[model samples]
Target: VANKGLKDLKKQVEGAAQDAVTAVGAAAQQVVDQATEAGQKAMDQVAKSTQETIHKSANQASESFSGFGKKLGLLK
Candidate 1:
């Protein structure tokens, strides 16, 4: 009877430990998912800003060249 009690106690302890590990794993996964989502959003914003800068630079260069051509009497 004493040995049976010991065995049952050991099983209960193991089950509790497993439950704790599962809870910790789920919490860690949630943190990782949130970080990934935030990183993706930041990357998207950076990409958009980069594209806008490129477009503005291109427009400025085109306007400058056009003005130079007009001054040279090349485009009238």
Candidate 2:
């Protein structure tokens, strides 16, 4: 009988199939996680640079306004 010749073959095939599916799923998940992490890091760097630029511009604008205020006798 074929079943007698391959008594445990069905179970073995099922286990192998399960392992292959798990491996593929893990690989795909890893790719998505890495991409997300990279995107977050890039966004953080851009935000920091923009903040620095805005801070510098604000400082310069405040200094210019103060100088004008002193000329107008509005600031000591």
Instruction: Identify the leading candidate in terms of lDDT.
Output: 1
lDDT of 1 at 65: 92
| Candidates' C-alpha lDDT | 0.98, 0.97
RMSD value for candidate 1: 1.4
For model 1, the stretches where C-alpha displacement exceeds 4 angstroms are none
In model 2, pairs of residues that clash are none
Candidate No. with top TM-score:
1
User: What does the lDDT come to for candidate 1?
Assistant: 0.98
Local lDDT at 41 for model 1: 100
Lowest summed lDDT over 10 consecutive residues: which window, candidate 2?
A: 3-12
Give the C-alpha lDDT of model 2.
0.97
